[model samples]
Target: MEMPKEFESFAEARKNNFLNVKAAKDAGKKVVGTYCTYTPWEIIDAAGAMPISVCSVSDETVEDAEKHLPKNLCPLIKASYGFAITDKCPFIYFADMIVGETTCDGKKKMYELLGEIKNVHVMQLPHRQNDPVALSLWKGEMIKLKEKLEKDFGVVITEEAIKKSIKVKNEQRNLLKEIYSLSKLDPPPISGYEMHKIFDATNFVVDVEAKNNELREMISGLQEVAATGNSPVSKDSKRILITGCPSGGVAEKVVKTVEEVGGVVVCFENCSGIKEKCVNVDETKDVYDALAEKYLSIPCSVMSPNTGRMELLDELIEEYKVDGVIDITLQACHTYAVESFSVKKVCNENKVGFMNLETNYSSSDVGQVRTRLEAFIEML
Candidate 1:
């Protein structure tokens, strides 16, 4: 169940292991609330402020939310309302404005909940994702958000500011991408679960440059050792292609499980993993177009007419040279989970060996998971 000594140990957030608004209060960091898909929050951090990704899932009943929010709102909304109903989230409440982006059903309702709160400004994103016009409007919204920050927090947003931020953020994104590429190796230099930790902690840690530099060195060192082929998988490893929902967990876990079962993960087919590299952004064409292009090209859980997912699966088989596929479904994530059967049917027709794994908050079913994975690897 444990990884090699070279890999970092994983830990979850403890009650006092984090800041309860005190970090922002003490640092005089202006807090801003942003619902799902506000990649701009990274921009906000780059602009010299703290952008809190409002998880808001800290409560029970969705009562107080009924006023502005609809009755049948998504879990994320109900959870956010649950937070407000249970206790005052000073971080979000203290925030002067809230930015909402186009993500899914859960995030849309978040905008309505913000209306019920006093002194909370709201920015609405477009329904279509990665659309050229929508991206422009969002960028415009960011401009307005900057204007507001200047007025309220006295922080001026300049071209030099956003452009510099884009570089830093892009560096982080690219570094993560490189880390993902490493998983293609046998016994992979890393695991899918390990990759999740890096992605999740990406925003939590303080020193981005130091951490990234450390990771680059570690991976590079491993690659060097691996240059002569010192990998986990030997000649007996089975290579699998993975496609599923945003592994809210890490993509490395799946890769690791494959290795554990005497298999290898040649490539990933999900958004947070290998799916990201498929996007080649040409910022020179237009910032909005480039941004939209980045998102549009990725293989996502949902697609219109439903051909994208199939195409991605087919290509993954050829590209990764994998023997099978693993589809990860988040607990109660209806949109992604509902499509699982259809995806499985396609995989079967195409003669691709695949399996669906369901999970909750805790990836604690290690024994059961390992058994299932081993069986799949054996079948492949």
Candidate 2:
């Protein structure tokens, strides 16, 4: 099966993300490292800084991270802290400032210790999604972040700058949504692993116009391939919807296992997927208010009574015609682990198969996870 040149381009882009960020730093560009999807990227952009995701997905640094952190904490937190302390990841190393949110206790506490090593700024996130007061509090936090960025970087963030950032960010989101939607075609033109790689690489691409143009070309190329009846997957393959914690860390074991068996992951409801791309910020409203409302609506497990997640899951399952749902929760990530019950209930109501698999960043459980996935895909 012939693939598009853009696919290779995306892979190569990620392969050199570290160097890309390093180049930006060398050019005297301010870099802002972020950990979660909750961070307001527009504000960071408005502050005249490059916002890059600093979350770590590999277990290579976990052992070192556990020295100062708890052994049982989320691998993401430990690996992230480990990278910071060891100066392993160039993104974290080149970051002029780090913006964190109170999305989870593990990350919040880790930020405190991380502050000792880096210039860390924490945002007070309110979990209650529907309350007006909570929105106000979140908006205030956004303003505080703006002021902090201005003070630290010696650049004032103006209303015009944020409005432009919002437009540019939405353009990227729309492009991603279009790319992700291509999976809705029977016998998807691309593999889940390939699709995920593109999403993960978007965070590190420095030139927004060039990145978006590449995505547009990729979309056209994929559609042309699909039109010719060339697909990377079989129509009979089980269409799976992934919903849970940030999956980039565990994708090697889980995503690869699914495709290796007989399932095709059609949708991702996590941070690495449509969770943040499905909605766009309203350009008609106040910049701060629009940003607060748009970001606060993200359906992460951190929000109390996270009804939005279930609703989004239900919608995706139908839209993608998913045959099953896999909820991958990282060990010690209690929020997603507990929320798995509700995710299962939603799948049950939709008459779709559901499985909850919990594991860490280590490859020690590779065989065990493979065995379970084999049985699950066989049952599907």
Number of the predicted model whose lDDT against the real structure is largest: 2
**RMSD in angstroms, all models?**
6.9, 5.0
Q: lDDT tens digits, residues 1-380, model 1?
A: 22223212212252222344445546666666654434464446655776655444322335655565665554455556654543344435445555665456565555565557634555555544446676667557656666766777777666555556556656767777777666655556654455555655554444456667877886687688568776645656776776776554434355566767677666656654556555544535444445445545444554444566677677667655567888887555676787788778877877878899875323467667788998998888
At residue 45, give the lDDT of candidate 2: 88
Q: Per-residue CA lDDT of candidate 2, range 1-380, in tens? A: 22223224234545478667877878889999998888999999888799999858888789989899999999999999998887767778788899999999999999999999999999999999999999999999999999999999999899999999999889999999999999999988999989999999888868876899999999999999799989989888999999898899999899989999999999989999999998899999999899899989998998998999999999999999999999999999999999999999999999999999999999999999999998999999
Tell me the TM-score of each prediction against the true structure.
0.71, 0.96
Error (Å) of candidate 1 at residue 356 is 3.0
Worst 10 residues of 2 by lDDT: 1-10
For model 1 the local lDDT of residue 152 reads 71
lDDT, candidate 2, equals 0.90
